[model samples]
Target: MPSDCTHEPTPATQGPKLLEERTIGGILVHFVAIPTGVAGAGIVYLLATNEFTKRNARNALDWHLTVLALTVVTFGSLFTYAEFTGQGVTDVATLPSPVSTIASVVIPTLLTLWFLVTFWTFFVGLIAMGKATFGTAWRYPLSPALVDRYGSELDFPSKWPFVIFVYVVLLPLVIWGVFFGSTDGAAFFLSAFGLLGLIMLLTPLTAVAMYLHGERDQSRNTDWKPHVAAFVGTPILIAAAGYVISRVFTESMYPPGDAMYVFLAAFWVSSIVYLVRWWMTASN
Candidate 1:
């Protein structure tokens, strides 16, 4: 299970407690990832609509988009290289070369590290604002470089280009590559990516919900029931969709590789729905 360290603080009287009672790893798994997953979906929506080009919001959006892009590029390139090279495809019980083991383990470890760093960067920023004695302030060092190019003329698009890209480009290509490459690879990639996307989508919703509901009041008791509900509901829906996709693709049987593809697709669709709903509610 992931950590839940990103939970909102209670009343102002009590000192700030760590978001979760568990360790850092536990908080990452439980809290940080959920909202981050939701935010990822929002990013896709923004990219699809070209909202990143706005003058006011461009800086923050671009910074986050860059992070998303880098993550995709890093993981995609490593996986592709591994697949083409056939570095670790053979049965490990037969004693594969040291090079294969190194390549296989190194790539994932680096990716995991990347996730941890990115999560911490965002998580700490959020916490700092929450704990500020005066007004909230959060900053990212990379924001300026990311927003430098976009001008004021671009308007947010309704077409959702990023969502389309996820469905039409990234998800399909990754699924195809993984399904053909190895079953374990397919399962791992799908679950990992799907989980990541889920967090991106969820995180933003939580933020927006808190903002709208004015949940940060010092005197009021924090009600975490909604957050907990969303946390549990999102993953179960994703899993259910994965199961359905697996059954469909494998003639009522679950093939590990194809099931991953199906699950990811389902997860993407669910995210899109959530984003649209949130946007509508927020706008209204």
Candidate 2:
């Protein structure tokens, strides 16, 4: 009887502990990968005892490598500028001009390509990090072939409908603000996120592409009652949170740009919560 009591509790406790470990592990690898790049991911991969952590680390490593490759455009732009002017590499912070006058179209065109490449990389990485944070399975778009080689599909159903709010509402708004493509004045206001207010946008389409390619969770069903409820509540909460943050927290009502930032942050955080909750409920 005594042995049964101690041993019984152990099994139940072990399961939750392992679950917590896996979740933490999954989050850690991605977080580390963001700053140190492949080296950070490789360290976690080497140390992880479980497959879940290892899988996340491997993907993070692949993602960083992809990002590195994409960043080559910046170097390409710099080199072309240098070759045109016949100067060696110098401080990038101070805008270095080509020592020689190259073709009029060359520098501007290369710079535009570099900017687009940078934007694309930023958006893709943002989506991958969001998936990791939301507990969704994310295989990076344009990730190296190595990410799939050892990655295994888990049996657990990875469906969460709240991911739609991300696609339907937040990201589009962010891109619009960044490009100043719309009349919303979102590009002007500096909120708590300030520059990062702009951060919460630009990845929806990339995420959608990932989803379409089966690089993300397979479930996006919006019809489930609880998910439907969450979906309905999301926008309302976003608006409300924005209002509260602006009116109650700030000195005065925030400008449209700042308000937009608050709303986006709220939308993203709330959507992730709903997705995780739905995942947990369905998994059980």
lDDT of each: 0.46, 0.53
Best by TM-score: 1
The lDDT of model 2 is 0.53
Residue-pair clashes per prediction, in order, are: 32, 2
Q: Which candidate should be chosen as best, given lDDT against the real structure?
A: 2
lDDT of 1 by residue, 93-177 (tens): 3434686667678778768867875776566445533432222222345544444555333334432323333443455455455
Tens-digit lDDT track of model 2 for 227-260? 3334435655677767677777777644555666
Quote each prediction's TM-score: 0.37, 0.35
Which segments of model 2 are wrong by more than 4 Å?
Answer: 1-21, 89-110, 113-126, 133-135, 147-284
lDDT at 129 for candidate 1?
32
Give, for candidate 2, the lowest lDDT window spanning 10 residues: 184-193
